[model samples]
Target: MKKQLGDSNILRNWIKGFEYCEIGFNKPPNSLVYLACTSTGRVSNLRIQNLDFYAPFPNAICSLTELNSLEIYNWTGLHGQIPSCISKLVNLRSLVITKTSISGSLPSFSKNTNLIGITLSNNHLSGTIPPSLSTLPNLHLLDLSSNYLCGEIPKGGNMGQFNAANFANNTCLCGNPLPTCFNSAHTSAPAPAPVSTTMFDSAPVPAPVSITIFESTPAPEMAPDSNSEFLSPRDLDTEILLLQMKKQLGDPGFLGNWVIDAICGFTELEYLEIYHLPGLHGLIPSCISKLVNLQILLITNTSLSGSVPGFSNNTNLNVIFLRNNHLNGTIPPSLSTLPPNLSSLDLSSNYLCGEIPQGGNMWKFNAANFANNACLCGNPLPPCFNLAPAPSP
Candidate 1:
């Protein structure tokens, strides 16, 4: 890193440094940031990345009051408490430090509202999340995954917007987006397996063979935050639409009022193919429409009974094969709005009809792609009535 810093210049009683910011211990494997300059009060953007710094972060950082972004990442052998003095940097907008060995209770961010993102994942940090972090008006993303955090997650404002995947692989986090923390969750609810949308319905109904009916319970008491939404649905009723476990998904706004839930947390999911599960039925959850990142979706040889799921948001779709299912509906022209990345499409052996939208990416499929849809039409298949309309001029 000395090579990256080049020759240094001295100014007055302190040395104003430039670009001592990025240091890595991986090459020769021994350099660490041990800044000891007299405070010149000039730091605006400090990024310390990929190093073997195992010491408490330099206290001199507090003197850099002008700092707006402090990024510390991938520190190996790092073991120390994040100084409480961090609250002194009232100008900080982004604080990201992941993959470190830093351990301790999380600090409060109530002193400032400038923060936009906070990433403290893959560490040994323990204790409940500071509920005050939720009240930051500009806060957008908070990743506390893969830590030893215990207790319930804060569910208010935008806190409920993150995917449950962001909170996965942790120790004993409950309520809202995660499983309920109450004993009522365990004793009163015996949910069955295959997850469907009815799970979020509020009407008094018997639990389906695939879902356990969770008796309602008030959410755990939360740390007070005036900016937070009033806890109305209770922690257990965040009204989550949790599918099966083992699949990470949570978007409480998309789920239930009793608690937080999501249909599928596979935000960037590219490939999905499930088949031959007779226990699966009903129209594919309308929520599949939210998987905007979906690329390959196949529901073949199953008991899936629905109109083909709409992929209007999933423009990256490259292949879609849904054969030998119990689906019936007109092929949505909206599928034509999908990205032209489509390399193949097979909607055969289902009960479908109507002229295929030959606009945009739809005509790329051939006869085999729409095979056995005795009631369908357009190119690749016989036209609905007369010949398929000529390609647009």
Candidate 2:
């Protein structure tokens, strides 16, 4: 590192013939004096990892224009906005910063074309994830866990391969594959109130959640309308749900159990998620199975305690997440018969017991998903296994 007290610009970018440089040491007064002897704007392919450069002058690091790949790691004391100049690193491909205390909204990176991977875990940053970041087609290993990020997860990206743990601990994040926020309008209605089993069993009948959809004739293809905004019918359904939630929350005496109604109201919904309401209890309304359109259902960390409802008959059902609840009873045999399209089925952290369901459509997931449940048993778990009987006794 060099510093110039007088003039140092005439010789910048003339690094003789150095291709890469790494500066991870302190810059004393003498070092600063020498850095001045050298010029700027020529350093490229630099890797200044694990340095106190940010401490002496955080703004100093942003001036480097030749960085093609930057890794600022183990520098926990760095703070403030990543200078907007970061976008100037047009050739930057990999940006990795771990074990830092940096805070602020990540700058918009829509202009970045070559960036392929970003790892910003274990930080103190907060804000909604920019949907633009989701547009990076080459991003493969994004680790933004353990941050203060809140809001609905941006969907419609090709993010199907990432496991749920990649997003674990971000309690506020909602939507597939993340669980829906318990207080979001979709799940804001209080959970079903507890009731005596006899009362439920003696009822004349359970009202099934149902919706009738009339197939309409297809519209003729036309040139794409430039100004037309296409609103999905499902989006309209969610808007109506939010409106109902707002009205209910406004009236103090309004029924607190609105989420149950929300679930019951959207029988035609193809996707459903409810997450993180500690006070929510009682059985999942049996009426949910009546939703023939249901494809993805996630209900996590509620006060719900009951048998996993039978979906044996719902061939359209695919992914189901029911972790961290009071749910107990044997693994449903009907789940084994899920349609071939089914991929993931997580029921971890509950009171569930009995042999793990070993079927064609389900059980493809790893064993960690079924952990913390005391009663579950299968090839992956011992003791719950039936002991081999003595010869033919």
Candidate 3:
């Protein structure tokens, strides 16, 4: 029994080989000293920082099952995968390994439900973030940024609390708080063909075209041979939508570089996302509903206000994220009628109010989907109440 209390000696032996790491007893004022044990003599916390060492992550440390927090910071020479055995530390409440040369996939922490924070930034970790991590109910702070991770971020549990910056610089991380992921079928599309006089000379002219140039760009001088047959009906619709969007959004300067013709050329666009643009303000133009082929619509972290636009015409829309905005007014009841393929929806962190439209695909979402609104009420949320009529007055 006396040998079991000697866990501190075991910890010392594990890190003794690392150059410049000062092994110490309990918490001290010095930053180099990195050990702290519980009253029972169990090693409860280990913080190793700024140590100059070239070694694979020490797997021996995972033996300390009593550890409550494990932090390894700025060890640029530390490499290899985070040891999977570390998950055996069921008491671990925080696991932070940042600014390291660690490579390989993130380990599963499904058993570590006590975890409150995880910061694995600035590493070479690859592959998708495991869906099991999102099931950690107490996990509120997470930073997996600056890694080679990809695929849709799991949306269950507390993931909605995090924003894009937490997952920034990952190769292709998507879903809520980031852009929607594109399926292989919708990966790439051809750019719109440039306008030419000979385009209509060979094909039958479909319709008369009208063009509106924004003040940001100088209007092109009409050539002597230029005619009204320059654009097709599809092109005209896209141009009109862009114009409506520009006018409604106050013509923010960030959009100055968007080539109108090139954007209009994506006649088969399946996904449309506008994210993290604080300068983007005003109501979502209702004209956006005209995009019948759009399967995902995400416009978040902007200053856009006004009611949620009706998407009755967008039957193909499978995902809709309009969170973290200034939007207000009741969720349009028409949304309740969207097809069953409308699987994902989030309107949280906005100024929205009134009963959430119930029925159809809306039943699939829970309180998290409509959370942080001004005064939303209904099933999934608390039931709405009726006001009593005034008495004799």
Candidate 4:
């Protein structure tokens, strides 16, 4: 470590070889000395790794108008925004500053297309990468990973050629290389045409997809088209239901609760039937109340598991058949009291409980709709000795 210099005038004579300088980072002196040396235009390289300098950040180094390479790694106590004046170094070829406390945007390399390599990863920099950096002609090494940066990974130029690991660990990034962002709009939207899979996915086997719900004409099972690849097996009926519902509820665009919306999108629909939709998970979403004109809804033999959704707004509903699934929770009295048109509610083969609500249209259904739920009670089943819910442990 160099001792702190008291006189600034004698510092210029301390300058060493023209290609490398590791002295300043270990014991940075007054900012005046850095400016004095770099202004001489003879210092062309900097390699300051783990600099334990006690002095403040010397932004004065930007005066190195002839620098060809600059690397400062793991230098403790180096704090402050990277000076924007460094962009004036039009002769720079390599620039790297990793594992530091540098908190600012990247220093644009003065449109100097001669840049060869860069590594600004593992820092506290928090901003979008400059797309113009890709314009550098000779750049081959790039690593901007492990930052708080968020945005679409740029697809322009040769940037896509880099491995996905080069830009990983950032949230909110989406595009061709990464998975596409959530886009709903499924109805007349065309399915992706058959494209060669080799260029699209690098994985050995295609993974199960979750959110690519689009509409397409039915392909014959005997001679299925390579283009007709849907994540759901019941695509034809779902398509028909979507097309029919599309005529009634103008396309609302698919979201997380889309399956519920699609089933209930029929304001003009009278009878709806569904069976055997596999891998159905999550709570039954609550938008089913939007079906103002639905009278009969029957869904059986599905893997759906969730509490019964609100039927308060579905006054036109006459019969609701949700059996042979793993639905839980008490039947809300609001379903019987609010929907003045409800007559039949089949919640058999589920894990429901509580005294059956005794008001409004609930009395119209017989014992069969309430069967198999051992915990359920009231008029049709044996009365529970206690109406109050058991206290939580």
RMSD of each: 18.2, 19.6, 20.9, 25.8
How many pairs of residues collide in each model? 18, 11, 0, 0
Compared with the true structure, model 1 gives a TM-score of: 0.41
Error of 4 at 340 (Å): 87
lDDT of 2 by residue, 21-139 (tens): 32322333212111111135354333323334344114544565444344454455555545556677555545655556666655566665545446566655566567776676534
The numbered model that scores best in TM-score is: 3
- Candidate 2 TM-score to native: 0.40
Measured by C-alpha RMSD in angstroms, how accurate is candidate 3? 20.9
**Candidate order, lDDT descending:** 3, 1, 4, 2
Candidate 1: list runs displaced more than 4 Å. Answer: 1-41, 183-393
Q: Per-residue lDDT of 1-393 in model 1, one digit per residue for the tens?
A: 232223212111124454332222223433223221113535455545455434544566666666655656566555665668878877765676677777776778788566655777777777777778778765544677877777777767557545576677666678777887775221211111110000000111121111111112222454556754664654323223333221232323223323311545445444565544455556777777677766556666677776876778777665576888878877878878875345346788877777877777564345756778647787756556763333211
- lDDT by residue (tens digit), candidate 4, 123-180: 6566556667667654534666655555555566546445566666553445545677
Instruction: Give the clashing pairs for model 4.
Output: none
Local distance difference test values of all predictions, in order: 0.56, 0.52, 0.64, 0.53
For candidate 2, give the lDDT of residue 171: 29
The local lDDT score (0 to 100) that residue 3 gets in candidate 3 is 28
lDDT of 1: 0.56
Give lDDT: candidate 3, residue 337: 90
